[model samples]
Target: MADISLLYPKGKEVSTMTLTEESINDLSVDYIVESLTKDIYEKNSIKKILTNLTCDIDVINYRADVFEDILNFPELRDGLVELLKKLEDLRELEKFNKDGDASSLWQLINRLREIDGYVLCITMLKNILNTIPIKSQGLLDLKQTIEDIYNNGGFDILKKDIDETMAKAQNLKSVTIGVNLDSVLKPKNAGVISLNNFEITNSGILKNFMGFTGSKEELNSDEKVLSSHKLHPANPSLTRMKFGSAQQGANTNVHIDTSGSATGDDPLSQSLKKVVTDILKRMVKSIKATLQKYVNISGYSLVGLMPEIIFYIRFAELVDKMKEKNLPVCKPLAVPDDRVAYGEDIYNIKLAIKRTKGEEFDIIGNDITFDDEQRIYVMTGPNRGGKTTFTQAVGHCFLLAQAGIYVPATKFNYSPVDNIYTHFPADENDTVDLGRLGEESKRLSDIFKVATDKSLLLLNESLATTNVAEGVFIAKDVIKAMAYLGVRSVFNTHMHELAHHLDEYNSDDSYRSKVQSLVTGMKDGHRSFKCEIAPPQGVSYAKDIAEKYGVTYDQIKKNIDNR
Candidate 1:
């Protein structure tokens, strides 16, 4: 079983359903994911979790419940967000431990640090989870997991042993190395003579120099303190060893190394790492097995949940903001396939986000459904009358609902589609080889090949690139194909004539679905942007547009007269 996942039920490791690229672009799905994960570390992974959709009802419910619990408990969301940062630290530690060139002792030290942090993460997880009244299967499983890892993992004993091991390994604060010179006064080799917890201050060096010179007075004073340790073995101006020091005169500053470390790959550093590793090897061995034993139980498995946990916590923040604006954000009821897919006061989420950002504008939400009576909609409206927007809104509803995020509606009762196929306007560049019509035809053929009754199809101004008569002819066949297949669809088009043949399309008893017409409404010659089931008002829409834009003959005459 998945130790705990905010995105799936137990034992379901992969998601069968996916939102196609066209569907993703048509509905601006990335905008939603990006908004949730913006300015966050590991944002790409969090986005992957949100986009990795599942078709199983159990999984959807499992995720939806987890989202609700996170939303309800502010403490849980805040605590998890902070914990993900520590998880990221553990990941960085793992990377450090994987360095091929680092000494074995170096890797061991970092491994200990990682497992040490891992222990704290689990303890923190248990403390936070235990305090929340989490009823969701996902969170409950997480709580149980923390308890299991804590109670059974000998954490108290482990922590004690780890601390002792770290102290033993890090007991020395400084090292004194003696470099052996070769024939021409060049340093040939180096080794550590002693390791000291006490600082070897410049005053002590000055005191030693005074003693070498037979001075009676003590040399210890604040003025003796200086900067970085010298690269030269001795001060050249003061002694024969300093004058004969490496190529540069003693007291010349050592140049900083380019490879992100002050020590660089100089002879001293190379030798120190080797000697230090050998020296510390015995001490780190005390906790080596302890760290290795819990590697599987305590590390990456819990780390895997970071992305999913972030997905919930980040979206929980968005949900809270949506609530502040009185925008409807409700957990959708994933109903049975036979039941109606219904939503009321449902506006596109893009508008809700804008409203939350303090953008003032009118957003009209419409009540919509796909039932036995209207299994598919043939939507027609005036130019820019929100046909495409509404079509995308429907796609967003289903996508967000299935992904276990709250839908943008007062109420949403939906039958989850296995997958959604979008037939939005393809790029002109994509149509270059086949021509627009041919390209569209091929895409439609591909959709039909895979789309089943359980799938949803969103067609936005499809086939409208060709002439009206040709577009209409092909569109009718497409709608008929959809009706015959019994799949739920919204075919929003500029070909108003396509909306007229729905009854004829429905009368064929061989087909399993009823097709109906939907139009974006108008009131007093102005666009209301509300959608409703109605016959295509082809001529009436033009008249309303003409009147609204002062383009009607009477209005033109009145304008002339006023001028």
Candidate 2:
């Protein structure tokens, strides 16, 4: 196995990624799996653990598996060790109230516990390693060899030899080891060594120094002796052994010397580094071996076991630790309401026109209420009135309520709707094989196909581009379709004829009433607009507050005057 120290030189670094409530809520099992896969790749352990695990599982199962792998990874092994260490630190910090907030940490723990398989993998690996007894004899041999080498003048001889070589080489009068004297030496010693005059005058001395001794006629005889010394441990014909176990021992000593010691500085820091490195190495080797066993026993391919192992291990450990400290872990469900009032309840804005300079502002009250039986409402008013605003507000309110947020209303009562369908005004310039009237009819047809009684439909100024007589006729057909389908809906239009038709239909005592009109009176200072709902009763000025914001009295007057 590769050195665990190299795998995790430092404990796994804690994630600095900040999580928000929105982000947490949006998380799905797929997201969790993808994240784990990414982390494994980043740690460079994906090929070792995750590649073989991907073949058999579906998306959710795959994610669960990857999560297991993360917990068992060596970096995370050290991280867990660090976490246990920090638990003590945290306890200490708690005494001083310096731990800041533990909510996020607790959340992390709970999420981990929710993934118990990952926890099991980690626990099992740790247990396996703990069960392996240390080799006392091998350790004793190592210690004894080190002690003998140091006590028997071996270190002193090596040190003296190195010191003498360095001192003598430092004063070489005219020679450089690897380069000409002028090129190798600094400016201060440029002329000290005469490289041009250097030569090997004593061939015998050179050959003896390099350990090559043979007659000039028998020079080739030494080559065979040297070759045999390299291949075999012993050769009697060889005066000096070219390679031996002693040389291997000396090479090992040199390795230790070059590697340097971990002391002469902060002893605690050195000890900590050694401890962490050793722990990480052990963790990596143990985890890899255990993971291999999982592959063997489960008969699940390597890739499949990878994610399952990672997720369960990491998630379980996290959750267990989180539970030990009491923290919030559960997610919230969606709320239901029907009568939406703006302030205390959810607020939704429909076509809420913002004011531009010189342009009138308008806000129609789309606030609606539905009981167990009521299905539809028909809103009627003249041109430039507040019909559209009311339609839009209703749409906005339903959307906001479904999303589980407070609306602008003071109080709201509503059934949770699965879909909100809208048939607002479409552009005349939009490319369509049929004209505006054909397009409108097609849209309504499409809506009737899927819309159920549970769906909320909002129709604004539907069929108004044609004559009032024909528009009301088409409008009545659309309403009847919605009623037949049992879909709850609100329709806004300028046709008073349709309102009258609905009134006459509701007047029959036998029919259950569904359509109602919001044609209240409008009072502008001393002026009063006729209220259609209660004839001769002045128009409710409250409706005009919305109109005054956008529709000017002049605009209404211009249309009425032309009619």
Candidate 3:
């Protein structure tokens, strides 16, 4: 009954938020998670957490403190890593015991194992609490709760008696079974003949091994002696087969129960285990009575915290690496108010990750803000001018900030969105049946179905797959609907007309969210990759590039005449 969580505050631990798969992909969440968790333990579990967002104001705030504690206090993180190791040991014990139907004896042993693990965990918690100044409410409460459990829960008594209980359980290794049959010669009742330290080996060839190793005269004396199976293998102890779930996973001798049916051919080993378990189950109950008090504090609960711990650990490590690279990674300010998200000097984190790999390239950092005046942006830019990169970067800032991790920005202040929805253009091939524009239209409609006024939307080149007029026609309505919903969106497209008419949506008093134009600017006839809030500069790059490269009519005519 130990109520503990790394993701939620003391009173709130029973909720979750999930982003659509399209959103997960559109934001490049998979790649970002992979970069964070590369070569780390429990990677997929970390990925599960990273992809599933939580918008709870309290939970997100709790996690932010927890992450800062981990990032700032290396001693705390080291201590938690030790705790994680103990948790891993506990998990191995559970995994070992999970594959079989536990008898009373095995169950008691399992309980003892749990008590031992819990004791170690409690001691580790005490050490962690005593040594480190844990700032986060999550970790502070966790260690405090564990100490409370130990001090008041009679765990001290359990610790004092654990050694005796474990030794008592381990003594009942082998049982001598004597089955009683009815008059029809079928099993009616069974009882243990004795509990022996050693089992009687009765292989087909092992009744007498002296004849094979004896002198020639002795071999002749026992002339009727016959060889059955090979010479009893090597050693009896080593040759014995594993029973009742001790699997190595890939082999039959492993601890896991691969025997699907209870009816097995081994009368002495396999079949007898069930009967022995039933007979002695009640007898071991008294011996385990002392340890059962703390069994409610299942180690698996502590094991459940593994994913959360790994999430923080890996992100902290990623942040540490980025710090080493001199990239600014700041803890985001989680604002509760609506219709506002602001970030400064924010670059694509994917680009930041590449910087760590010794790759040389200049990353363009851009500033953006969303408010009533510019809640929705119609961005037009030159091709390969970082329109998509800048758009994706904005989504990343919101996502990483909302998840309570440090963002790849110098500073970011944001209110938590209920969820972020993305409509990054899909593969044209996938739109064959619905047609590219039709499929995209349906997709955008689907996003509007769940998006709220507080949601952050990033649309990368929506509706630009067809002719500009048609694409612009639908794109304008999309912007209008966003205005009506008061949702914050970044709509980047090549359709200049789409970016041209921003006041049309803002002039309508019914629409609360205003649409504005943004563009990736050009300097010295080269794409600057800097995004700014302005009227659509509209990519007239064909004329500019033609003029720069001397492909314009006057320049070409002058060159021909001179030639």
* Winner by lDDT: 1
Give TM per candidate. Answer: 0.86, 0.36, 0.82
lDDT of 3 by residue, 363-471 (tens): 7788888876788888888899898998899888878877789999998988878788999878868888999899999999998998899888899988876477788
lDDT of 1 by residue, 439-471 (tens): 999999999999988888999999986477888
Highest-TM-score candidate: 1
Off by over 4 Å in 2: 1-287, 290-347, 350-367, 372-374, 382-385, 429-431, 507-513, 525-563
Q: List candidate 1 stretches off by more than 4 Å.
A: 39-41, 183-186, 198-268, 289-296, 557-563
Determine the C-alpha RMSD for candidate 2 after optimal superposition of all C-alphas: 22.3
- What global local distance difference test value does model 3 have? 0.74
Top-down lDDT ranking: 1, 3, 2
Tell me how many clashing residue pairs each candidate has: 2, 69, 7
In model 1, pairs of residues that clash are 236-242, 236-243
What TM-score quantifies how close candidate 2 is to the native fold?
0.36
On residues 301-415, what C-alpha lDDT tens digit does candidate 2 reach at each position?
1122232234344444443343333321211122233422221222222121111112343322223456434456776655555555455555544443332223335455555
Question: Worst 10-residue stretch by lDDT in candidate 3?
Answer: 247-256
Where model 3 places Cα greater than 4 Å from the true spot, the runs are 38-41, 167-268, 272-287, 554-563
Model 3, residue 51: C-alpha shift (Å)? 3.2
